[model samples]
Target: MSVVTNDEVRRELVEFLDQRQPDVVREWSLLRTFAEQRTVDAVGGCTELLNSLRRAARDGQEQNPAAAGFDDVRPMLRASAGGGASRRLDLLSLKEPLLRLWWEHRAGTPAVTDGALALSSAVDALRMVQLEEELTAGTETISMQRQQLTELSTPVIKLWDGVLAVPLIGTLDSTRSQSATESLLEQVVVQQAKVAILDITGVPTVDTMVAQHLLKTTMAARLMGVECVLSGIRPQIAQTMVQLGIDLGDLVTKASLADALSYALQKTGLAVVSADQG
Candidate 1:
């Protein structure tokens, strides 16, 4: 795509009008001849000329998809195709000059303004197409980004083959809670995990919502035939839980990830052996 800068377009227009005076003068003479010679059929001639120009513009856009401002040419040509024979001839007269200016980006050409205008129109058309493409792509982009954010924030880990670790970090709102439930359930099925660990060492605070979310994730994992062990309760959090009357009577709780792992191994019949004794 050739980019026509504002300065370059201005200079070309100046020089074109200076040197191409005669060519333009000649086109005007032809228009006059057509108007006088066939004033009655001038409209027909103008229609034919406009049709030819329209076809040429279409062909140009097709041939060079990347050509700057190619799309705008057709609409402009259409807009100029109104009224009597003389007006139509005037419109037709613009075709050759514009095409010439486009093909040869040189100075001393009188039709520089037409060329510049066409280029501007083409740019506008291309922008519309580009905007549509971006909007379409945004949906996919948001989904992928949300997944990445989940993966980064959630401390869910897959220990070896059938064992998993999910460390909860930061605040778990309703959305995060829902996501955590979904993720744990999917991973259990996909990994066929026998044991899953829920570690909350990095959590700064705990509330009813977060507690509820954790409970949901645990239950969902169990439903998938996976055992879930909650770990990493700070002393302060434990006190807060007690004060808030939160009950984990049914849920398995461990002091840390290591303790949870040991428990999970035993539950899954994965015994820890001493290598030195062997």
Candidate 2:
């Protein structure tokens, strides 16, 4: 039989914990190191843990890993913030004091050993639930951070009146390319700018695939009534574009962002002449 499968063991363990609930919470709360005391929600979390154990001890839904009381742990874990290996060890550490008390209460008896085993299983179950929830929270946090990073990397700048620019600065993979395009188009529609600039000065290489991404973004902007300017084409990149026979087909290209900005200013019926010019 499984450790938690014994009815008599569960009954005895629950009763012992109920009578000495305060003691268990008090001792477990004391085991915290100074850092843990500050990092974790100490006394309250310990009380919640003890209560969860007692509930799990009698909970018929305990057969499933998703026990009713385990859900209570999620809030505590969220407040803990750094719920990594140390937290897990601390959870297991709780079992020791409770077991010691049980041993002292009924030393050298078969019932003592049995009840100890049951309590250990219940605590371990609670710990596993906490660990699982921590992992889930961690994954969600990472995904959100990644998305924020992507948005940061692909920013749409309102460079001039009726002109917006996207200075892509890394490998233009399909995902990033799509993100860049979406951001640029949204700004174009929002600002209703006349010219959209896709500057590739920081892009390391220009290949057929890269060219395709540029063309798709350009065409997308054009469909929205915005003329797209492809800038940052060095001599080497121009040569590569030619050798690869990647026809831009009347796509306006510029040698630098300065030139692109000048062209955009002109196309929008604007100018950047000398300050002294009449």
Candidate 3:
């Protein structure tokens, strides 16, 4: 009734051959012997299958000419892809049935024509649904890849008290730095935290441009009434920052996450729970 149903039948045929039934076992044995004994051409099986289908159609031609026409066309329709020529063939596959329905209508069988039209419409609708599912899956895969890239490139961590520790783990070229700036700002506003500690310890080096971007981000945080701290500066990085003449005097810089946490806690008017306090 449908291409899907026909595909299922093909699968069932393959499965039937695999089950090794007494009748099919003889056929399988012959095929195995043929493959073992002779130097068969690569496409011999395809050619034989096509020839057999052609002979079957020819044998049925005298019995039912219309059904033979449909059988003759089934192969071409099955071989068609969703390409231009295949689209034409798919429509042509149903054309013969529609033509028969037209003749039947003239013979006072309008119900036959109605049934054929409904089946044809149903097949076309099913094709559209399959195409839509393929497109949606492709779109979702791309979206997931983008999400994974975002997670890998940007680092986010939560610290004690209300502070969030975000470490810039690699080089912050202008594009990545911009994304980081926006993502950090959004998280800070959403969390409503008083402190955001950006630890750059994992950053191997710093350039003037990256330092400027950091300055801009820290300034933006101040405008939003949130304190932003730079932490985890190795000696080499500190030297680079100073040599590059990048002024971070307006912002607080800490030697480590612990120091940054202490500074943030003091600024936020909060104290860490010591053992005695507990």
**Total clashing pairs for each candidate:** 7, 0, 0
Q: Model 1: how far is 175 from its true place, Å?
A: 4.2
Candidate 1 lDDT trough over 10 residues, lowest sum: 76-85
- Error in Å for residue 78 of model 3: 20
Winner on TM-score between 1 and 2 is: 2
Every model: Cα RMSD to truth: 16.6, 3.4, 15.8
RMSD of 2: 3.4
TM-scores vs. true structure, each candidate? 0.52, 0.86, 0.48
Candidate 2 segments exceeding 4 Å error? 1-5, 33-41, 60-65, 83-89
**After aligning candidate 3 to the native by TM-score, how far in Å is the CA of 98 from where it should be?**
21
Model number with the top TM-score: 2
Tell me the spans in candidate 3 whose CA falls farther than 4 Å from its real position.
1-147, 273-278
Candidate 1 local lDDT, 103-180, one digit each (tens): 465544554564556444433444343344344445557788987887677645687578898777888777777777
Tens digit of per-residue lDDT, candidate 2, span 1-278: 33434676667777788888888877887885324664255677787888888888776333344788677776776555455556543577887899888888768655777677677877778767767777777888999998888888889999987899999998887878889989998998889899988999998889999989989999988899999999999899999889999998889999999999999999998888897886
**Winner on TM-score (1 vs 3):** 1
Candidate 2's displacement at residue 219, Å, is 2.3
List, residue by residue over 1-101, the lDDT tens digit for candidate 3.
22334334333323322342333223322442234423343134223332332333233221232333234334333333222331322222323443343
